[model samples]
Target chain A: MWGDKLSEGIMSIKEQLQNRFDELTRAEKQLTQLLLQNYPASGLGSITDLAKRSRVSTPTVARLVQKLGYTGFPQFQSVLRAEVGAELSNPIDKYNKWAEHAPDEHILNRFADSVSKNVRQTFSRLQTEEFDEVCALLANTDHRLTIVGGRISRSLADYMFTHMQVIRPRVTHMTSNSNAWPHYLLDMNKDDILVIFDVRRYENDLRRLAEMAHERGVKIILFTDQWGSPISKIAAHKFSCHIEVPSAWDSSIVPMLILEALIAKCKKRIGIKPGAGLTHWQACLTVRAYSESSLRAFSG
Target chain B: MWGDKLSEGIMSIKEQLQNRFDELTRAEKQLTQLLLQNYPASGLGSITDLAKRSRVSTPTVARLVQKLGYTGFPQFQSVLRAEVGAELSNPIDKYNKWAEHAPDEHILNRFADSVSKNVRQTFSRLQTEEFDEVCALLANTDHRLTIVGGRISRSLADYMFTHMQVIRPRVTHMTSNSNAWPHYLLDMNKDDILVIFDVRRYENDLRRLAEMAHERGVKIILFTDQWGSPISKIAAHKFSCHIEVPSAWDSSIVPMLILEALIAKCKKRIGIKPGAGLTHWQACLTVRAYSESSLRAFSG
Candidate 1:
């Protein structure tokens, strides 16, 4: 019965960890605290390393693993490894997993369903006041706006920056290069707004940058996933978008949609005449003719 | 009666142009041909310039504008300007338009509904055989893959390139610089795949690049919007995503989702092991101890 319960997915590893938390001895509790802090990383290490880091004996580590309903340390590690794998798998891996579980569903249908749920959940969770506050901050041209997004989210940052640049003159998207970040952060003032996009497995650099910006009294607006990242605590306005998808990779549909809504609100608040900038930009493109001949000289 | 019909928005400018095409005089035909060929641009020019370019008299230009249901040449120009504005409005402008149309609907709800419709329409329009063919080509590891996206689409190209790079080797996203394009194009072979993303207000340079690649026997996969572009004719594989949204700017949610689907299919065909690359990358980040302290020195 015990073996069947362990194999049946009766409880998630995290749930098991929490349920058994209070029952652990002092030495086990020390290791538990370390495990909770370091999380999957602590689980990835060998028994000895976990003991050494937790400041407990190797026997304590083994006992904790067995008590957690695993046969041994390897079994415990396997669960952690699987958890981490699910967290970091690419879209392809995620699709395969979904296919296995729901054999009847078409991949396209699955994708459509996942995206729909994500957008709906995101809006349902958002507070009206918080969204308005973000819009008000963006609309205020006096606050020099600096937007940052991590590796995968760099595209989103670019999207927001491009749209916002046309709406207001002072907006800038920070470059991906870590070296240039400090220079940008140092220039930020109390009145400025620092918009950040950092999702799960949040970057260390982003956290540090947010910390520095907060110190400078820059109003921080953070867009994160449902996981609710560490940076959220420091941000003056924090909004979490649902990124859950059937695949291993988190879908960015919610965040992108939220960005659209925010841009719309900001435009309304700023009273930007529709098509004014677009007309000017299009006229410029027209003047340049934006044609093959104009580009050919450079190609040659 | 004529004024009422004009006010009803029953006849778009293009439709009006087509409906009255056969009734035009010979000089008007020449002007019409020029207007059709250069389109929107033709409407932006002065009457004298249009007459000079089409080798017609200035009165001929005015006659054509009047025949198209406008009060005069200036009225005709105003309609064209409005069309162009709708084509090029930024996200903020788009949001404002949506807000004005549906004041009762929350912006978040509107966004969700728009994105949901976009994804559904994109999938509904996509032919399964074409998607599978695109997937098959991408999965072939022997083929060198090169991706190019227009200015606004550069981020998407980057997103695809980044994900594909991890799944397999030898995938590259082309730089936007015109000077470097020739060098990249010259290296294409029959076995290589050149994926281009150029939506409406299509760039002439992109069209020329596609033409050049076709001459070299390179397989071209073109991803565009519903209007279809000039490059579609030359491409071996063509796919269009629906980008209609409440905003002036085209939402990229559909295209991004399609890319994810393509990646999933390619991964399946290629038989890539689940979590193989992700594990390696995560381990590297872990080894680096991706944290603030590690990044602090760079800031200093």
Candidate 2:
């Protein structure tokens, strides 16, 4: 019960940063500002990287983590990682957790709450300026957009490709299996944008592909989870989505939300007619109506 | 401003159903109970179908719709359809709508609110008994599961297929192309479950495939938007997700959430260890350490 109470009382790292804001040394305050601005990503990388980016010494970063009640930077990062993982745990896990504390709440209600929280936390972490920059990259007509995602993330890439292709030309979703990366990258240059969705347990091939694109001077926009992929270092623009869910599988809802938002921005920027794609798709459906009608006849 | 106020005052069909619950006659109340138990779907079917199922006269169904303040059942159904569409609209559309009323709120906050509302609305419409029945059908080892989606919904099928494959054997995601349906359906039978995702502007081929599957006596579970596809008539289990968004494209977040929930239930029923799939996936990532390290090298 004490442990449960302690856990309940414990402040999240973000909360700790906010609470300790006034008490920090000038250097620590600067580091905290950087962390607050970038967040999750700022906390995910190695201490040296954090130190360099925050313009603070490595010891200062260690001291800040200590001041936040974490044993060290690794412990601090682990808390961040755990937070991300907890956000993505399955509904059942969340239900069990809720049951332990509040046994009367319905499981479905708990799930709804968790999902809403995940979506909220995701958007809350997003930087508007960074989002706008990525949208600009995607909206550029001259830029050849090549999108790729790890094995599981491939669905997201496909979803984005399908929607983006409707509003703009030359948008390709690269299949991870095709040994065709070399061919696909052959013509890609500085003007091309390589958007990759690589999260934790990231596919090595995807990383290699990102590196290859980076070497070729292709601008890479990386979308990953809070675990922070190695490709983030080489990325021109990096978006770290919060993927934690109560299930075994990472919640793709946040990533999907980002994809939807980005597509919306691209459509707006490209001046696509409000219903051009839907109208075309509807026409295609009409042409196939004979079979649809027959199916309805049988059902009736 | 009055128009905006009027729009705000418009009660969703669900709200109307609740408000009018106490006023219906016994026959209408039975129909109301049926509608309450199988919402959206209960409201989705033709008037004759609803009348027959609710054990009420056709005119009674008409009276019920009129009592709900609609001109007719068609008008009532259109409101339901619009509500569903509004749930799936893009974040920008939601932001603009919010801006017209709540001018000081942030766009990201508005997007978050809309997404949360969409997920909540989707779950609210889902019947617990129906969800459990679907899980039971999916978890039964005796039944072969075949999934198919319309052209745009193919990624969702793939996503479901991949996750289901990990927890259970013999799960198949049938591709819409390759003219492979004949081969895939050759062995399907009464015991098999054919899960089809066909939303608004439903594909003719997918409907035909469902009809063919129906002819073979295979059980059909259809997932569509609130527009309600014709295939619902043939489906043994029909789930209409809220796809209305602020943008031109339908939002798939609600569907994805359902997929995740279904998979979670199936995993629970099948007794799969929570971390088994994740552990194996982690192993695969470890095997590809060279590329991962190379990526880290670049980052460092």
Candidate 3:
């Protein structure tokens, strides 16, 4: 495992949990999952608190740490505390202040302006042919699709996976766990599509997966922030979305817009009809809403 | 349980599965969860397809259907098909058409305009005071926080939960399962906050949840689409974000912007310093990237 080499002292608690998962006892495995699901922070504070959160005894926590090769709970926590530095993988430690040059305005207005500008700028650079090409590839069911995103962007990937899975078939949303990627990779065949989302503070594992998938003739569709991800070199199609927001994290809003558009277009191209019940129900709701005179600020 | 009164005929498959989950064998329970996660879509396809997706045997599927009170697979399927009509409680079945007034422009351009306008419009009417109040409440660990979102919006809720859980303690992200909410509600105290995201095709169960949470004196902070959800009637703070987009489903981008902004504000309010390790690592990464001279575009 790639992580094993990094295990000496560099591997994160998350990495250790994933690499050593099979060896853990059932109760300890549950605790490991809890720690992994909310790493660093979940491991910080105290062993008693972590144990209470996972509903395990403090001794179980101690044993798990000892099993992971930590001297004890305190050592495990120090490593966790150390991870605070290397874990700036998403939009974080920013958004503490507004833009330096912005004129005085309500913070809400400033954020709105920033996000609105992001959308406008993103579209200005987007290529219609690329968008159409992505839709075409996705509309074809023959292209077994696998989607992966970074720590923050996985939510977007999951959204795309959910919509794409419903619109057609052969869609897979890879778990955030990198250790499981190779198993999923073995299923990839030529002409299959892999949608990768990695913004700034790019993840190397995803790039490695993209390279391997590329070597296997899998077409890559990448969604990255404007600054671009290192994964672009291997990508067959890339959508460089504007993600910079005034917030602590880069926003997923623009990528989300493109994702929705792609889903809508693919659904249109595939041309599958929804159930009659839904059509009737929707029509009724529409009429009722229109007759009642809408109070909604806006709706899709 | 509310599901019982509706179970005779009117109850949906989701309600039935949740209501009867405890009685199922372990494999059947897994099947039940698979169906619920994907809902009407997961159940609407062929029985074999559904079984293969869940890795359950066809007989298990049949037995599960029988246990759910169906005479046979086709009967259970008919119910699933019927749900297509009533399941429009999300941003589904839209994005099939562009605004009639749109000229000969690329679809991506039109979408960018629409979403950018959405951000602008949402901000123009947003109340900064309410935004601040929501942030203040979230910053306070004394006020336990429970967040929920309907069908599609739950992704956003999960994103918020992930960030908030890392930012502070006393945060709970309720599962999409409505049946499980009461258990979480039992722990709510006065001044606790319940943040909800419900778009068009608003969920009745969510409204009921809000009402119940309101009765418990838990402060309600709602993030609803422009058409507005009925839950607004009970909310202490309401953010009616614009969600319309030219897509098959309502766009989550606008609501995402607001959620990120709120998260940023809360993190700021909490004012926790990162461990020395992360601060040093982030500084190194930032310096390296800056010196390299970015090849990509916009950055946060």
lDDT of 1 by residue, A1-300 (tens): 476466547566766777678988999988888887655454555678779988999999998888876799877766765564444322222233222323336566677667665654445446676788788889877789999998778888987886787667678899777777878877888989999999887888889889888988999999998656679779998777768766657777778878878887776666554554454335445645544364577445
Candidate 3: residue B37 lDDT (0-100) = 74
Identify the runs in model 3 with alpha carbons over 4 angstroms from their true place.
A1-104, A272-300, B1-104, B272-300
CA lDDT, candidate 3, residue B239: 86
Q: Which digits, one per residue and each the tens of the lDDT, describe model 3 over residues A1-300?
A: 465655557766766675565457757966875675344455654678779988999999999999888899877765664455344324343222232122336566567667766766776677777788888898887788899987778889888886776666678999887767778888887868999999988876777788788888999999999988998888999999888777677888888888888887887776554554454335445554444312121110
Question: A1-300, model 2: which lDDT tens digit per residue?
Answer: 465336633667777788769999999999999987754445655678779988889999999888877788867876765554333222322233322222234344555556665654445345676787898889886899999988788889988887877667778988866466667877888889999999887777787878888888999999887556889789998876767666666778788877887787777777654554554435545655544333344344
Which residue pairs in candidate 1 collide?
B94-B247, B94-B248
Can you tell me the CAPRI class of model 3? incorrect
Best by lDDT: 3
Better of 2 and 3 by lDDT: 3
Candidate ranking under lDDT, highest first, comes to 3, 1, 2
Arranged by TM-score with the best first, the candidates are: 1, 2, 3
Q: Tens digit of lDDT per residue, candidate 1, span B1-300? A: 467456537555654654455456668866875665444556555678779998999998998888776788878876765554444333233222222223437776677667766666667667776777888889877899999888677777877886677666688888776657888877888988999988877887888889888989999998888888899999999888788777767777778888877876776656544554454335445645543354588545
Q: What's the TM-score of every candidate structure?
A: 0.61, 0.60, 0.57
